[model samples]
Target: MPGYSPPVSMLPSALQTRVDAVEDPVVKQLIKDIVAFYDTETPEANAQDIIKDAEVYRGLGMILPERRRADIAIKQDRLVVIVKDKVIAQGDWEMYDLVACLPVPDRPKPTWNVVIANSTGKDPASSIVLTLTDVAADKFIENAKPVSIRQALLDSLRPYVKEVYDEPVLHVTVHQGSREGVLSFLHRYIIFGYRKPLTILPLSQISNLSYTVVTRLTFNIVVVLTSGEKHEFSMISHDSYEAINQWVTDRYLEDLSLAEERRAKKQRAGPSELEAAAEEASQLPEAEDDSDEEEAEFSEESDSESGGEEEEESDNAGSEAEESDS
Candidate 1:
């Protein structure tokens, strides 16, 4: 009777049964954590509170469900999706490339599809998709006036914008012949992929970036590499094209300004102190040769003086000899 408490009759019969049947230590601990999070004395007695609390626990990876239903929730500024008690996808709102409420013909209500880039992976360019219920999707969108998918993306991106360098702001799907990939701009690199990076272009290595609006529905992105090779990504949406264009233009200008600053600094500083010292060292042999030349001239003068004195002494001896002969 110590651990046993009267079950609340307000909870859905199925959910209450699931909670009562939980025997796994992990699940029990998760329930405790969830109860502590809400600071409620008897969360099990409140069906609605327990269900909402379960979402937070699920998002934090404290619990895993048995089925593959969308358990979407926001925790610690991240949008997380848990499926079968496993974290299927998670990211900051700014990292989300697309989020839309699409109608499912077979289902009674519309389903939300959220696409986000993996920012911390080796293939940071890849994308993950999460499907959520209407309530979860509404929470994910946050209350924005005249709600639209593009508006939500812009709202998320606004927080990351800075005075000097903007956030990695571009999100577009790329199509190359038979292959397709998702493209995203990060703080320092441009990544392309769906699950792994197909291509990673650093900001420094990006030589030329441009985009074209082919039509109201079609857009194309073109990139010119330092090697002079051109790559074109075609068949993009107009809204996506505009977003990419703004991001690329801003980043390109910033990169150019930074490059110019570096060049000017290099010119002003000239060579490094070590390099200048090495140059001076290389000219030391010339100074040594000059010193040698001076030494040689001094030796030549001394030799001539010595030879004159010898000649004078020889003349004096010859005069003495002539007198003796007289």
Candidate 2:
């Protein structure tokens, strides 16, 4: 029987014409092999498995990127890939969501938007010190409506804190009426994987936060991370909200203590040239006044010499006059 014919609609016109025009049997066989390959399927292919296979291809000089980037680690047995400080695996997350209902009497419900800002310094160059900001909608917070912003936040401070400034250090401005919006903004910076010390304080408690000297009302508490990176997290706190705020702040501070120590060491290691120059100047000897003394001594020597010459001349003249009279 003649070879089976493909309908015009079933085959692309160009491909159909090319196949019909093929004069050699060998060329037709090559086209048949390509079609068969295209129709074949691999059973249940996983993307992770395919990526792992491609990496091995690169090892054998198959393909390489123009510029090298970070490599993802692979788990052959589990068919998974691991990136720096992150891992991907197939598993159910529902089981991981189980929670034990241990009673936390002091834990307050999260009421305000978590504010994360940079608090490095007032200077333009320093990186932000992450801080949480809490704004009051009503006098719902306990403890006297935050007499001052610093007072509201300062009392909640932990020992791991490096410095507290009553100014906003963030390069960008963020505001939200709801708590979720504020938290979503903060979530972007939380990937540092370092447990940063958290400070939750009210903006109303601090007086200096809005002053011209400070320029911002956000209270900043420094958190030294174990990774040598400094971050700032701030939020408004009320008396009723203090419990949960305290929990997060304390945990962050405890985890960042090692980073705090490292930061302290780095800051103390070397002094600026200006500071060194000032110290050297303080140790220098005081200047002396020698010009007046030198002038007085030279004047006295000249007068004494002139007086002696005059006396010698007078004595010689008297001797000569006496000899002539005799």
Candidate 3:
């Protein structure tokens, strides 16, 4: 019944106390086993790397499809998820995929989503989704973006700014069909949040998009999808409406330009190269499903003092906008 105590000892004082309170010997050992998996693995070293060199982007977030909230940090190429100050999940850039700029639940301003797969298991059962504000999210995206494609993406997006475009999200209510939700948009995606899970719409799917000022206080956005599906949203924001509308027009045009680049590239590659590329793409493993979450609320969260309750260390925590559920 003694099993392994080494892993338990390796845990920080606060988490060790939690493990000590467990009454059952088997339960205690099982918890240690999970810890051993992390300690003996690469994540401990990853954390050490953060401590020594890299800066960390840390925040709180929920796991998708499972809906478990935890403390998350990203440093260098590593990301860790902690509950009650105990690390429950951890992985590096190479082990799992990363996605950024996805929509998020109504919580705080300058919010964005950072999703990385839970990499402890071989089969990849779940993902850690950190809903981060701009400071943390920006740091994450800077590292997560692949060097190879970063230049290509900028080249594809027309009128690309040397610096990424910035717009402070003004939380406003929008209606879709029978549902009313908070509307948020980025350069590439639309996220609608309310009582249900956040529904995301990617700009790439839209064939045409238009916005109209209905009254002095309200406006409507009409979207036509590449599939010919049409959707509309009505939102009221006195301060940010025109700015948001203009931003959307600019981004939508950029999206179309990027799409055209893809076509041009394919044409230059010829039929045989397209077939070969399509076949190669098909062999890649599929990403995990991220919808079907419950209600999530955000709060104004500032960074905790450097390191733990006492120590200072680099906290760590980007990728792309996910496609629409509608």
RMSD of each: 14.6, 22.3, 39.0
| For model 1, the run of ten residues with the poorest summed lDDT | 57-66
Better of 1 and 2 by TM-score: 1
- Top model number, TM-score: 3
Q: Write the per-residue lDDT of candidate 3 for residues 217-291, one digit (tens) a residue.
A: 777778777678777877655666677768676785677665686688889877796888999999999986544
**What is candidate 2's lDDT per residue for 45-146, written digit by digit as tens?**
433333443211111100011112222212222111122222222111111111111111122642211122223212111111112224331232234354
lDDT string, candidate 1, 16-133, tens digits:
6877788897886566455333332333333233334322322211111222444454433444455444344444444533332222223476543333433332334334443444
Which parts of model 1 have CA positions greater than 4 angstroms off? 1-69, 77-80, 88-113, 118-121, 125-127, 131-174, 180-207, 210-249, 256-258, 261-326
- TM-score computed on alpha carbons, candidate 3: 0.37
Clashes of 1: 2
| Order of the predicted models by TM-score, top scorer first | 3, 1, 2
- How do the predictions measure up, each by TM-score? 0.33, 0.21, 0.37
Candidate 2 lDDT at 163 equals: 36
Ranking by lDDT: 3, 1, 2
Candidate 1's error at 280, in angstroms?
26
**Which has the better lDDT: candidate 1, or candidate 3?**
3
